[model samples]
Target chain A: MEIDLQGIVVIVGNYGSGKTEVSINLAVNKKRAGVDVKIADLDLVNPYFRTREARSQLSEIGIGVALPPEEYLQADLPILSPVVAGLIKNPVELTIIDAGGDDAGATVLATLADAFNGKSVHMLQVVNPLRPFTGTVKGCLKMRNEIETASKMTINGIIGNSNLIDETRPEDIYSGYEFVKLLSQESGLALKFITVPSNLMTEIDVSRFSCPVLQIKRQLVPPWKKAVKLS
Target chain B: MGKVLMKGNEAIGEAAIRAGCLNYFAYPITPQSEVAEYLSRRMPEVNGNFLQGESEVAVSYMIFGASAAGERVFTTSSSPGISLMSEAISYIAAAQCPAVFVNIMRGGPGLGGILPSQADYLQATKGIGHGDCRLLVMAPAGVQEAVEMVMMAFPLAEKYRNPVIILGDGLIGQMMEPVEFPDHLKSEPSNKDDWAINGMDTRKSTERNLVKSLFLDPTQLNDNNLILKAKYERMKKEEIRYEKYNTDSDYKVLIVSYGTMSRVCKTAIDQLKEEGIEVGLIRPQTLFPFPEAAVRETALKEGCKAVISIEMSMGQMVEDVSMSLQGKLPVSWYGKCGGDIPTPEEVIDAVKGLNV
Candidate 1:
């Protein structure tokens, strides 16, 4: 069930596809499984939800997290931190870069053409059928083209992140898995992983999934929901 | 354990891993991209972290994050990329976050050509970013030094809680040579629970941990700045390191250079010596916390009347030489900018023109 993934694993998805969430969960899961994991917060276009936002949690779990300098934390200024150079030199297990949504967000990787020289990087586009891009085959291809052209690094895999937040059902998971399987075949992207609601894991036929299944837990719960869960 | 033939850029990458810098972030820049490409696969074997960031600007910040958590972290870039990283390096310096950075220096103020050049001398030594910040600049003269200096950078950074810059021009980065890695220097993880912003662990202090660059009050910032300056001054007394060649003899000209340029100077000096032209060289191993006393003493010595500062930039370090000489000896300058490397024969010609 585990591939010796010691190189760069880029996580890409549309705005609400939960790419960062998947990245965070994957990093923790790998690190807990005795892998030396480091997460690069490459999600520059979006600020609200970034892999770095869970710095404290990642650090606590023995996962190294490289974030852009604190000055760029909240600033919308377009500058990749020098830490990327460091990351390229870093010798760690499972370096997951949380890239922004679509081509606009992914285009930033073009600046790093030098580092990608002679190296094969896996850029996985996360898909959610509930989202506009995932509802049709053409929409998925359009998103993939945008990301590939923007990143300047090819998209080698597809991550199916089907969910309805806390309301995810087992049937919905089966439907989503099928939709992504078709998308993966059409787009020629290897079906990398499928994400499932942690509570519904017992309901689904976990053994049926050919690739790994990651459990998604919202790192950032809204204040209203936090109070309800707090009790 | 054995001397392996490796490129300088790859050596630096391996040395950082040996130094226990398991966490790294960076964006790719020309001439130094091999460092990133090498680590991408090596990190996985070691179970380390390697990430190509959105830009050099964000990569430096990522170093800040990893280092702030008390883990050994590092980043690398070139001239334009380093320019983007200056802002974060300043913050790392001020916060006293022990981080390592390698600048495989290339040419220019803009999109300089991708040739070997040491055009970033002033930026490396004179604090590229704002405020009274300083970095420990270690200049590697060749591939071997590049590997050794990186191994040394980790402990030095941790001990001082400061950022260390490995200044090697593109020549060293591109050149391949045999490097013997020190077996004893494989670094271990440091427990910075006292200062690191690790989430509230009761094993240490419960105070709020903040890693920010802002200090609103001028006086408070000024007072801290003064302390930092004092630290730099103390560093001069302890960390100022350089290599002296043929200074025992009454040499007519003294060549001053660092990084790959210094190696070139050494070659030129050897060539001049073979030709019966009495000359010497002062190769600065540490650019910042410079070997000021050595320069002053060497300049003051009788018969060593002229000093020439040769570099890949338009003589950025020449200003420092001017300050070091201070009329005691006539200090001149010569350089090749925009990625062009000066030949040993050209340096000899420049030396003849200086007429020490």
Candidate 2:
């Protein structure tokens, strides 16, 4: 199944909304599908479970990755590499900027507004109904406005990714789809897709989804859980 | 009983709410911002008041006001932010108000990096504010312990009518762990008939209550200080908390540590045990009440030759260890600061360097 994600997909969400995990799996999925993919770790607020943590695997798979300088890579300062500007200007078939969570994190994306002007930039607000601010339609819409105001970019789509880490189930995806559907109709943002664990796909009815399903391979686990490579 | 994975900051917030503390005032600072964010949505649902004050300084006063009015209240901040609230902490201590302050400490001298550090040890236990005041400080080693400590902080604060601090490092704030808030720790709210400024109308009494730290007369101020000192002595006598591991058996050295650093020491001790070096640990769950007697007795244990204090700060807790031992035993120190957490192997090397 070809998920039609293309051209500078910027994923923004509240913290713990699973935006980073979604960004990693989306990059891997499109890369495996033979598209030239590049993921830029622009998250400067959160210090853990970022796209850069999967740099070794992403680079090993020939997916282009842009990160901070070698010395400042692990640091949480808001230092954006110059190459990120070049990537946004030149454009790849699929470029995923896994932005930091919350409006505080999305403020960094405003620096690239000029480079993304008139370009095919799909600023998608990833929503998890399980999280605090995005659990209701009103909260999600308030966050949508905040992200757009902070980034100086409009959100064109919503990606429902309601989950409870390892405790997530098939019903969560279905329930989240309904929640985000009403959110989409209320906010006028397209319902891009809802994510389902690849292992739970056999148990989920694909025909129930109106939009394409992004098969998520869990890559971000707590330190106690055994780490698994998505690819 | 049942366990749920939670971030330390969120867990502390939930623990406070579960402990009947409905008023929360805080300003966001990493890595403890999640606590404020969690309570913003949660407080209203539980009929609690959650406010993001203009600054840590303002929030500290907000806590003082709410707590003075006989409501259970708390606030959380990081290192520099805690430093900003130190003045208010001192005043709250002086006025004998019941409030809890949580410091999910990060690296600091100034606006230090946002990583785990125990650098606030001296600031917390020794010199939190101007004049003379000491907080009942507790350091939790894990998420579950943090929850339990936060729950205990309220009752302990009301028990003595003083400010209590839950000192945690960034690791405890950022890491996710399975935690269960004990059912027994959910305590009834303490009554405040004598001192709380809950207004005469609310209490339906003719007598007005004053909750101020100021005293014009020098003799009155001295008497207040003596009263506060007596309470400290009582706390030291009744509330000293520490855990001993491997101290029952003969050991060459005793390791003194607290908070997340203690867990690292436990692992290092296990590794040392495998190498035939018997090492024990004295983890002080409470920092202010200092567990001095426990340290002295552990140091006096037969076959214990030396004591080493392990911390993330540069030799802060070691002074307390030396004070506890009272020069009876030789004391050494191992520490790292500025967001650098010492590894288990590094701890092992330090233990070996002690050489009994």
Candidate that scores best on lDDT: 2
Q: Name the fnat for model 2.
A: 0.02
Shift of residue A226 alpha carbon in model 1, Å: 71
**B194-265 per-residue lDDT for model 2 (tens digits):** 578866776756788888889889999999999999999999999899999888768989999999888888
Deviation from native of the Cα of residue A21 in model 1, angstroms = 49
Misplaced by over 4 Å in model 1 are: A1-231, B184-191, B200-208
For model 2 chain A, where is the 10-residue window of minimal lDDT? Answer: A220-229
**C-alpha RMSD values across all candidates:** 20.8, 4.8
Worst 10 residues of 2 chain B by lDDT: B182-191
User: Which pairs of residues collide in candidate 2?
Assistant: none
